[model samples]
Target chain A: MNALLEAQGLHLRFGAVRALDDVALSIWPGEVVAIVGESGSGKSSLLRVLAGMQRADAGQVLYRDAAGATHSILDASDAALRRLMRSDWGFVHQNARDALRMEVSAGGNVGERLMAAGNRHYGNIREVAAHWLERVEMDPARIDETPKNFSGGMQQRLQIARTLVTSPRLVFMDEPTGGLDVSVQAKLLDLIRGLVADLGLAVLLVTHDIAAARLLAHRIMVMRHGQVVEEGLTDRVLDDPRHPYTQLLVSSVLAA
Target chain B: MIVLHTEALAKSFTLHLQGGVSIPVLRDVELTLRAGECVALAGPSGAGKSTLMRCLYGNYGADSGRILLRHEGAMIDIAAADARVMRAVRRDTLGYVSQFLRVIPRVPTLDIVAEPMRARGVAPDEARARAAALLTRLNMPPALHGLPPATFSGGEQQRVNLARGFAAGHPVLLLDEPTASLDAANAEVVIALIAEAKAAGCAIIGIFHDTAVRQRVADRLFQILPVYEPA
Candidate 1:
């Protein structure tokens, strides 16, 4: 109850192809909900819709704010939506390049969110950027370096630092650890997991990795054909899947 | 009255690469939520739970359904609203704390935490004061407040993340694994925050992998059934 976001009768299409159809879901404050499916299962498409990164042909998306007010995200203006992204919400791209300004220095990346909000003290901005670097396990000395010079993992870390610096209440992520090596992914996962909990964040993570879902999400939603086939608590879904598709999915992961 | 509810929600996907193979991702999902409730969503790997969440957040468009909410004495259906209406809803009604924290590079942890307040027209000094207080409550060391939180440890950065989430004091919160890589102590701190939020009448939805934590916080469970039965 006391809901934060709600979607009903969502419909979308690309040419003759339907990307989303009659999808519904809700998020309360302080919740982590994961969307899991195969690569073609429309997981990314769904995340994009919820984050307002894409437009739907039909249906509605409603959002409730901290002030106990509700608005329709589907009906929001570009400027209003942009403001939401800048203040009340945050989005984490699967690829750091999609989210970060690759040319910006690590410090500038973090400080710019503050600058956008009107903080003018250059010294303070750099100081804070260096601090965030330390928090994400990057070398503070690299704060002046551009993401182009950093390793994939470090670039991802910098991206996270940039997005999280403003502390938006809602965050949308798409395969946050997808492109990294296993070792790098593991480290990033650890960082993500820790930060998520500490913040009591509400997340919608899209991934095909069962382990990632198991380690990070509180509730898991399995998708097939752009529709939800199964969903429930993470443990119960993974351990005692009910739907036959769910059973197969779980077993396959276990077998893997 | 339910704080949030959905009826007859459905969604599908069409793959272009395979000559537009149509895939049904969600079909006829019905859900209801109340304040101070933490409901856990469960299902198979590809069941569209994430899609459903996105739909709820207005990220994904729905085919047909009603996402109804009781807010400030009016009922609104999010599924069919316009862009302007949706933006207002986002600003005052919903708060989503995502899996990863993304900031503008080089912003101090304090300013990042304070940015929300500043947007609301709170004075810079006042917003920073509140941010500092929240950081302290979350156990962030004072020294880190002035820093960027970029290079800190995972636990430390997450604390800053938490500080920012709480800074807004939103009524409804969305979480994705609020305690993933954290050591026991940090996880406990998050758990306490969740408890506090729930007690304060904030409704919460979350994706949690930690069974103990899920059991500790969730008020009930919701399940989504896969669309097509396996052969």
Candidate 2:
């Protein structure tokens, strides 16, 4: 199958820092690819560039739609990019509060996404919001409550609900379970894994924790100094790392 | 000794707009709760489970019932208690986590969770510290602690509500759908918190729709069937 998304020779920089250098990757439909590296290794910058949240200095990021039309994310108009973000793509932030509206009710937050897709009926919108809340393991009774009333885990869960409510074909997640307790992270990983399998979504995930990547990603890309040093099947990479850096990364996690 | 007991609790509503139609929600319910007891109420939707909890919490008036509570060396009937007495009971003896969180806007979540302890005359610093501890255990991010919960997601709001209710260590606690909005991980934390509360000798009455949660926390089960009468 043709890849659902592809990035070729992508490059980005911040002053003297080369945030991403000649990064190239592809994600097939119903696949999960995780980008793993240490802090400032350019994994996040690469993800941001691919997700169209940041502009790259050079390279092409192409998304092949379900209809087989390839669209260049960098060349797409702002309105077109916004529509894609609202309808066909999702981004899950490490800090959920940054992605959610702090002043809106829980129902309003989810319902707004539906409204953006042209749903206008109040009853219908609220019903879908409630359904998404329950799907995310949240109580629908607090639909009128705000995100500020929620704990970190619940906020993250709600953020997932908000993003997935539209059933986007592709999702970009940045450390979805970071800053959570070990036990909480474990459960969240299970939820994410289940949802990804059920929805058949193509996902590009960025995380420093190898365990999370191992659990959720089908393919793993190890990055160092703004370049992908190694890439392969998740189990293969973890079980037998060819790159020395990949070996060190895996061993460091085990040592910790 | 039973810390709380309800004798033949009954409730009905008259819908005047619907031509005075009488709807009986609860019928002659009897329950007994001892210290360190956790009882889960299980029932279908519209089965008066929440109505019974509301009645137990003194949020709804009972047409006929005896909600007796052992509070501060006195056995008080919450169903018949005056507003002032009920307020005192709620302040010092009862803690409730309703289906939704209701609060004034602009009060920070930390202070909101700390209010129960503050009401019991605990020092602000100590109460806040305890509140922070509970919030952390529930996996509430520290960055949002200073902000108000008025704009929080349903699940996040529920955690703050749970933290506030659990903070006080009230003698008699009522929880309605306590874990309904939480994921397995956060839900497990709540289970542990409930266990700790039970160990501390609190008497709990809760409605848990999640069977797993009920299985982990409940010592016994109470069934509330929907009450219907001849039209």
Best by the TM-score measure = 1
lDDT of 1 by residue, B1-231 (tens): 477788998876544344556678888888888888888777766788777776776666677888876555576898776434554555566566655565434568998898766645689899999999888877787888888776888767767777777677666666766677578877778888888888888787777778888888889878887899456
lDDT of 2 by residue, B1-231 (tens): 699889999988654445556788999999899999999988899999988887787766778979999989788898887544666788899999987887544569998898789878899899999999999999998887899897889999999999999999898899999888888899999999999999999999999888878898999999999987966
Candidate 2 chain A, run of 10 with poorest lDDT: A233-242
Best by DockQ: 1
- Ten contiguous residues with the weakest lDDT in model 2 chain B: B13-22
Instruction: Using lDDT, give the best candidate's number.
Output: 2
Candidate RMSDs in order: 13.8, 24.0
CA shift at A22, candidate 1, in angstroms? 1.3
Residue B125 alpha-carbon offset, candidate 1, angstroms = 30
User: Where is model 1 more than 4 Å wrong at Cα?
Assistant: A254-256, B1-231
Interface RMSD of each: 14.7, 31.9
The lDDT per prediction is: 0.77, 0.87
